[model samples]
Target chain A: MGMCPEHYIDYMHDYLDGDITREHEQELKKHMQSCVSCQKHMHELSDTVAFVKSATHIMAPPHFEANVMGRLPKRKNVLGIQKWLRRHPIIVAAAVFFLLMGATLMASYPNDNQFSVTTQPNLVVDGQTVIVPKGEVVKGDVVVKNGNLIIEGEVDGNVTVINGSYMASTAVVSGQIEEINETFDWLWYKIKKLANDAMALFE
Target chain B: MDALVNKRIKQVLKGDQNAYADIVNLYQHKLYQICYRMLGNKQEAEDIAQEAFIRAYINLHSYDQKRKFSTWIYRIATNLCIDRIRKKKPDYYLDAEVAGTDGLDMYSQIAADEQLPEEAVEQMELQDRIQYEISRLPDKYRSVIVLKYIEELSLQEISEILDMPLGTVKTRIHRGREALRKQLNNL
Candidate 1:
């Protein structure tokens, strides 16, 4: 005897939420006139709504504005390095990553076009081409700049060619053979080394 | 007033730090009320309200000037309040008795100083009970109820403040009212 039609219950809630259509509201009112259960339910819902609305609003404490003003972080330099860094974390990350990557390119930047090479004890130098003879043993690292390196014998250390090419013919080298042809090649060499080192460490 | 608020925002952007004081004053009471209703403790309400204002000032440049500043500030305040409610350990105390109100209750603290009429006092005690019930609601429903009824915001506004769909907001409001209605019926 006290149950409301399911749709009528929905109507009651929709009315209280201020979302009921005019037609539904009229229908609900008419239904409520002959339905004690719906009337009681509507009264209960409205009472709770009114009760919350009637809650006593408190005043903000005195000096609230002063407190908020005081707490504003020292904005002397609003976009100070540290604050800007904190706000744009992704940009900061990308900036940092690229900066470190650019460091390799900076080191490889050609300051001059000088043809230079570290002499080997048993090496033959022909203009811009440095060659280790067929049976000679180089004592230390061989670096050729603005030139080419031709190794046909044993070199006990690394062979780094800068702004040039290298051809190893029956060469026995104890270290890495790095060919840095240009700025970009140097950057790629350093990046590849870094990535390999990182992977090794993680593994 | 919106024009004035936008002006203050511009001045603050131009290194006028004191211009933010106007914003703080204009919204302090309204924000404090929402904080108070979300968290029934006077001390926490004041602290969160102050924090919201500080955060807003720090991120003032990110605020879209096209929209009402009130909504932006309210969103910040409500988010802070909801975070606080979630951080608190789930309190399952089912008591709504005015006598069972805790020591940190704002109403009990000020009830002594208010020499209100008999009817007013009774009404206040009732409000205290309602506040207790509101605090006991789950965080999801509690925010919707407080924003809708206590803050008297429209459904659209509540949706924006809570960053939920309007349909989700409506569903939460309905469920929250049912919960409150059941509590009143039991009482």
Candidate 2:
């Protein structure tokens, strides 16, 4: 029902390749009866196909056989057991069953988790004016090198500043803070870092 | 015969190494032709063809006996060619005159080369033109043209080689051939 007139392009293609089925050949002929542009296209396509087919005749290289022989793997001798298993249906079935069972068991088992950890160098604040915001926690190790740091929140870890002024405010601390001017023990350091970081935030 | 080929392959898998040489010898020429035509370089074609054989042998155990051996090997060759073609950028340089019949008008230069026989030289040149045009075609069509015309494989055989429906193979070959013809006409 949806059949439109077949184009000369299709006929040309089929004629060039000789792949046209009997039905299509008739359709092509019917279309060619009235269409001249496609017929010209078909003629050109056919001539072109003929021209190319006549021109190119590349041959394989001389050493093809030797090269192939060189690359082949040395055959391994077949063992009696492998041969026996190859022919034994029951053994093959059992082997397949066991292999699947082992795979299924492995898949069903939950794996134990081991702790994975990574450590980064402490944050360094240089002498440049650095601002720390209020009400934030500074956790883990932070190193400031030669910079001004303002902290106003909580620090749950270490804070080290080198040649840098640290502003601290009311904040919780669980770890130590060290600066060129002063060193605080773990609890004091944590509180100082947090306060400084929080204050720095506003500045 | 298909089963027999499969049995022979199985035998090769079972360490009958000599059986492999038989398979190679049987398929080598046809595979070589496909590769050579696809690559347009003899040395590369030889290498690709040989590799196809080696791969076929190594994977012999996985081969299904239901399919014809020729179809399987042809697939390998076609794939190898496609890989080679894909590695290159899309544009391919073509011999313009040979590609178009209009260039045949310039046959005067050929008449001057004394050492060449007239018919032989013309045939060689024409072959080169055809090959160039074929190579310039898109891979989908180029493969169909090569399989149908140069290899002279049936549409059914091409379908098997490509693992496509017979109707699809026929349509593609037709379309591809037409494209080649168009390209050549412009040449």
Instruction: Please provide, for model 2 over A183-202, each residue's C-alpha lDDT reduced to its tens digit, 9 standing for 90 to 100.
Output: 22333444555689999999
Residue B173, candidate 1: Cα error in Å is 1.5
Q: Which stretches of candidate 2 lie above 4 Å from their native place? A: A1-6, A12-35, A55-59, A77-203, B1-7, B90-124
Query: What tens digits encode model 2's per-residue C-alpha lDDT throughout B56-85?
Result: 987776677776889998998899888977
Q: What digit string (tens of lDDT, one per residue) describes model 1 on residues A70-173?
A: 88888766365666787799998999889976975677577699999996668899998999999888988888889998999889987889899999868999
In order, the B-chain TM-scores come to 0.81, 0.76
DockQ of 1: 0.64
RMSD for all candidates, in order, please.
Answer: 10.9, 19.5
TM-score of every model versus the real structure: 0.62, 0.55
Largest DockQ belongs to which candidate?
1
Of the candidates shown, which would achieve the greatest lDDT relative to the real structure?
A: 1
Give the range of the ten consecutive residues with the poorest summed lDDT in model 1 chain A: A75-84
TM-score of candidate 2 to 2 decimals? 0.55
lDDT of 2 at A61: 58
Error of 2 at B75 (Å): 0.9
DockQ of predictions, in order shown? 0.64, 0.36
